[model samples]
Target: MTLQTSLDDDAAWQAVLARDRHFDGRFVTGVLSTGIYCRPSCPARHPARANVRFFVDGAAARAAGLRACRRCLPDDVARDERAVLDAIAAIRGSDEPLALAALATQSGYSPAHFQRLFTRNTGLSPAAYARALRSERAHTALSAADRVTDAVYDAGYSGPSRFYAAMKGRTGMEPSVWRRGGEGMTIHWAVMPCSLGDLLVAVTAKGVCRLSFNETAADLAKRFPNATLHAATAGTSDMFNRALAGVEAPATAAQVPIDVRGTAFQELVWKALSAIPPGETRSYAQIAASIGRPKAVRAVGSACGANQVAVLIPCHRAMRTDGTLGGYAYGLDIKSALLDKERKA
Candidate 1:
């Protein structure tokens, strides 16, 4: 199938300038002067704009007589992303964790080589992925099982203690609270002015469940629709203030707890966003590729749009494949200012 994206040459050029990884497989850059093609995220010194021609894929670049870039290895990267995706599917579908040797055999890669490739592509080792899968199953089971013990067993854990430990480590909440959708939850929220604009933060006992810009308590009510919402008391907890400060100065945002929720793929996308260093940026394509779903660029964008935590999760770091700013839930101006601040810091 042909590699495709909506980006035009001018947009693609911007991605090249930013070394945006999201556009890596969406398009290739053919340098007229060097007769070589590279992925958009190539770290080599960029060629002059006039000397670069964009192609939908390396085949097109090769047809134009350009040799593939040794640095980016675009084709190999795509294949690796696809292979990791297949491995993830197998892991998620299996009742038990597949052995590393078995997974390597299925992917036609040597054990050592496959482990490295899988980690490089997904930012997760196979074992880590399996653990995450079990955690997700346990969380789902908790929501429907008649008893916590039943849920633990149903999620494939041999022991309830293992499930309890994992849940505490991941969510820092009681299983009953998680399963009941924030029942008996007291969420303190306040809207405050900041560099970006109006910042709204809602915190559960577990962590920050919602942090957004230009939204109101009414919006929060709609989001939780069920949980109690209160203005920050005369003196909120230090953790609440730290979360607020994190939004005000994202570059220095402390790693406070977060209770944000989403589907597995959405969570993966958010995790990738949070890992982007301050002042750095990535395209949706790069995020999708990082999650081993290169073809899910559009889905990645949707996940970004659905993000509720704002600067804490750093959703603003996600940009257009062309390095241009894309949509933001608040506004483009706010997004631009946020990026500028991070870059200056």
Candidate 2:
């Protein structure tokens, strides 16, 4: 059945009453009686179907002013262990520049065995996963105003020429041409101080784009060491004020402006990540398959690791096959908190 069918409202409500583990994070149930929303596996008393409302994400529910149930703590779950490890190993190894056969032999597994085990464990073969990771890192570096050569080298490529050629083959553009400033772009952002720590939102001209947490001027300096950041405090524009308000309350929606710069492959991966809804997840292999590169699982994981924007891009939603919480650029604790918050939301 299709994903939407799997989340049939009637069936999902029934699952909520039954506290089905499989339905965890699939959707949320808002109880009209208590004025709270909970996960399907919540231990709280089941509410009448007539009093329940379903939502795809906590932000939407919160936007409706419905408080999350304290008992279920739906928003506190993290990535499954299997998915985490698979994505992490894939990302870590992506920078290795070694041939797959030699790499497999060194790891004491046949290439075929390695491929199967990797896919089974992380949902993607090693090579594809590695490439995605490298591309993502390259993108993140480039977004911060780093030179193309610097981004390529930092992502473990030998040189800019090779990186440019590979990026062109994958995305049809030279990296330098993509780094235009936030010129005419308008981004929406939100800031929230929830269980996951402080949050920041940075939206693109098109939609919600960047989301970060517990960031300071120093942190921003570190992330974009070269860029100039402006603070908007006049409440003149809805976008700027929304972002500032999100920082104050931690869950409000805010729109701002963004200047994204990255290689074509990296851009593709980021776009795929942006499509993932909150509270749901996809494996690295699944992301690769979605992008029409079934063999690029490892690369997908790398791209996720390299993501600079946090929740807005939703890279944390990617996991390994065995249900493990994977490595996160911001740290495993933050990852765990973000996952838990969504699950419980």
Candidate 3:
């Protein structure tokens, strides 16, 4: 089927003029005057509207005696795919971290330019991606290995100090604790009715580990399977009460300690979200920029969605770049109500 089967001719022409990547691959832009065709997102100067015709694919354009443009290489879908894959393979193969310049060089791209390209395509900078790969490897080793020290080194960490530094606040548990799937940890949990829904509050002795809406002990069991999940009697932990209060009136909620866990980048995102004033809001782009990763806006949104503790970190304060409520785990209605409550306060 042709693009005309789905996209109208005028819509396809508008896409060419806008250089929209969303339209690329659905059709080719054939210029009758120059006998050249390009992907919809091609950067070449726009041809006269009368000279342009849309084709279903490169083969269709070639059949009409049109050659593909050299710049965008409309026919070579695997060109950039191979580069991204090769860089990923290089990062995973080496025991040590690869430098940005080195990885960009291997891909025949300039360091600064490739940095943006890699981040845009992967939703992570090359360095962050490498850390994530190493961290995943470390998690696997730590979960099975008998000795923490041996597991750290086995995961390609330079030393225990670096491993601890890398994993600091990542799992919110000591290395030994993660090794046993929270074997030694005791999590006190309770489900309490709240303004929005039933709130699940689970805490370690150190701080509140989770605060979510409509979740239960069953959900808590999945996170800390081996750990003892004690059903706390009412008035058990003052911290849990404080957390419940926070869920109701976030502005006046006491500062309760948090024991949530996430990646290094995710931690940065959470920190930025927490810094947002209750009545105020920040765009996803602003949050990404606050953490010194301006191009990581999409990554910031993913981190927000991954957040387990609601209202405490205040992911609800995050908005779209266009000044709209993007989404919330609970619902847009809840997000709007929270913002309204904050604004009224």
Candidate 4:
């Protein structure tokens, strides 16, 4: 089927007229009458079909000199602002025992009120968001070859026990095991071109592990600086080929292997992302609260941003608190398309 076939052109145009957040970023509707293109979910009046054209991506619309719609601020939405600020705050205040009550107090709201408002605005509470931020920092540090203990302490985890517990809860494996980097285990991976650019699929002995895009082999190496990576052509490994095929289509009962290495919190966030069913979405704040940290809305946004794995981990399922489509490492266009596809499914 064609890309446009997937879009309910008439309904999409109506959604544009209504400025539906649900359709935001899904596709661009170009108005031949006004010489402008807009997100399908843009809130604008309907124009005649003769005056309407559609593009699969923003770049195509922009390349034609049709500006984005002003209503949805198609070009300006990003989830990173919250994530960045939260990360900075976590880094600066690592020595303190940051709590929900403390964050609520600082925000001038009671913990309950703060929780509601924060989740509404950023999709995560204060504490959970902060924990994710700390976890990300710890993961980056460890990925850079820092000792596990040193990275944990540096990330502000109070002690080894707490860090270990958090790690196991999130990753279903120990940090040491993750660091070993699929040593004796075999990982199956495939490279393919995709809508967003190039795609990379890596699976371990357990489940679908890593799906990344727009990165060269060199880039992948840098991302997993400490892990050993190998090139796998078709026919080299049945498991690897199976993983590639499975990711392209839905399947059941296949245990794909994963060689994931990250701080406890990031692993947790990623695991949560994976749990999101295809065709469903969760706000970033909801993800944070689900993990028992309700104060880390911003941090949850960061974890979503930091995610390296694509569809299989389902970072695309995350949305802004106001139901806005947010940033994706690949691009907002891809994020919108992925969500749209899932919604249709």
Candidate 5:
């Protein structure tokens, strides 16, 4: 691509090299050799640096006497977006998981290609997305229904057995336990100090169930009234240490397993938040778009607010669309400090 004027030209070039879809629509890439411009994330072969330029937008590129490329159609994001939305609707409306090949064919692309496109845009594989839909539906139903059997059946499960089998990992606990708010589970929690104040890490057998700031055993007691809460013993296990590592140094910390609950959309928002690197941030709209629900920007903010575990999920990495840090549950001061810490790391 030919060089062009930009305040952060080097950063734009890096985004091009990475094919960073996050930069799509922010600018258009103009190729002098081909005399056509494309989106920054165009899968088309990169032109030589001397042959390319960047424009503020597609109109700017067109004004510069460049046409749009066909492959990555820099101006036709809506077409691919429609295909993605249609597929998502189908997935949510289905009682059973749609086959990848079938969904791809319906979207007018090969299965392999469609899989990549779908995942790249939505940050989830088709099957995984379907599973999330199923789990979410089941959970919603369970919350309102008196009987688990009826709830599962109503949620489109063939039987209670199948529902349990399918929701083995998606849920924080068994259907009954979850519905009863940890009726039969045991949670151990400990309060410790960190760069932030008063870190509370609660764990179950599976993993950390909750992590937050300025919480005590009494706080844990209130949150899990139905469960048994124990203070950490003198010999806290390696799992507890791992959870602390996640809180103290999340950027390089090993993957810390979390056994927590969330709604379907919240789970998607959380997954997108986790995908963000330590030093980088994503706008709430960007997170919503990554999950193929760009219109749910406000809901994304709600999900961030609803986060039970802090730092590990990195809700602080999300900001308002205008690049300002939005509200945080703890406080803005803590959030700003966490961002600064990560960036420095």
Candidate 6:
């Protein structure tokens, strides 16, 4: 795909400041002042934004009369992302769980460093990623299988007891019920037009769980295909209406309660995001420091991206250290509008 198709200049600039590895190999940053091109996540000092240019690839950068920065070596796209990708490839490629030491050795880094590197890039430590992967595999197996025992074994769990215990926390339901795709519970959802766009609010007996934009009732049903989904009843409308109002005016959205799910670290990052007062913002680096994992800035970004509850969780409040608006799930136009609304409020 073309560079413009992959990411616009504004989005690419965010990657440059964050040193976001996801954008590595997708584009090269040409520093006009230095006459050099570098990887998006190059650690070298950043040139002035006006002096920076983006090229589709190394050839384009060279054609523009720029040499690659010796430090980041933009010409070698594969190696720029090799360290983290190698670790990820090894973990995903293996059926059985690979130990930290083994993965570290394969990546040519010491165990501790490898763990940090892996977590910084993927947002979860190696072990945590393994657990999540296992849980996902189990969930998929459960969804596709007719029998609970079949899923349990297929998920790689040694026994039913362990599998049920692990799945309980992940699905917040019994193994049998979860395997049935939340068959026992009723999910009420509504798609209401708000200032942003079509806002979909879905809730269970617990609380408001999902608040998404540009989605239809069908989208919500697909999220929990096993659950009995219906339009919001009068009893449930008030709670969700308030949430919709919150989306219209974020400064007033706080008191609305939400029931959401995420990993422990993601919860921490979400909490930090929620604490960012209506009009203000925080950098990904700052959020990482607040969570006591100062180096997990990328992971913090991942948590923001993974946020299911949009305005209530306030992922848009997080930005890059350079004070530019970073990536946003719902489009930067919406992100900018939300921030603008909050600041005015």
The full ranking of all candidates by TM-score, starting with the best, is 5, 1, 6, 3, 4, 2
What are the TM-scores, per candidate, against the unseen true structure? 0.80, 0.42, 0.56, 0.47, 0.88, 0.58
Backbone clash total, candidate 6: 0
- Candidate 6, 234: how far from true, in Å? 12
**Whose lDDT is higher: candidate 3's or candidate 4's?**
3
lDDT of 5 by residue, 1-345 (tens): 233433256767777897878777667888989899988899988889888888887788888899999998888665566677889999988878799989988889889988987887777888888877888888888889998888998888888888999887766578977888779888888888887888899888878888999978888888889998888875556777887777678764438888877877888888888888887888887788787887898999999998888988899999986568989999999999989888888
Query: How well does candidate 6 match the true structure in TM-score terms?
Result: 0.58
lDDT of 4: 0.61
Q: Show the lowest summed lDDT stretch of 10 residues, model 1.
A: 1-10
Best by lDDT: 5
> Per-residue lDDT for 1-345 in model 1, tens only?
123566777778887898876566678888989999899899999998889888888888888898988888877756766778889999988888799999999888899999998876666789977887787788789888988889988998879788787778676467777787766667899888777777888887767888888899998988886577788886566666787778666765747778776666677788788888888888887787877877898998998988878888888999877678999988999888888888877
Of 3 and 5, the candidate ahead on TM-score is 5
- In order, the Cα lDDT scores of the candidates are 0.81, 0.59, 0.79, 0.61, 0.82, 0.79
Residue pairs with backbone atoms closer than 3 Å in model 5 (clashes): 1-51, 1-52, 2-51, 2-52, 2-53
How well does candidate 6 match the true structure, expressed as C-alpha RMSD?
A: 8.7
Model 3 sits at a Cα RMSD from the real structure of 9.4
lDDT of 3: 0.79
Q: After superposition, how far is residue 141 of candidate 5 from its true place, in Å?
A: 1.0
Give one digit per residue, the lDDT tens place, for model 3 in 1-345: 235545678878977887865455568989989999999889999999999888898888899899999999898533454566678679879999999999999988889977876664455688988887778778888877989998999999989999998886566667877877777888899998987878898888777888888887998999778888899866566877899888777775438788776665676688777776787787787677555455688999999998878888899999986578998988998889888878887
Query: 213, model 4: CA deviation in Å?
Result: 1.9
TM-score of 5: 0.88
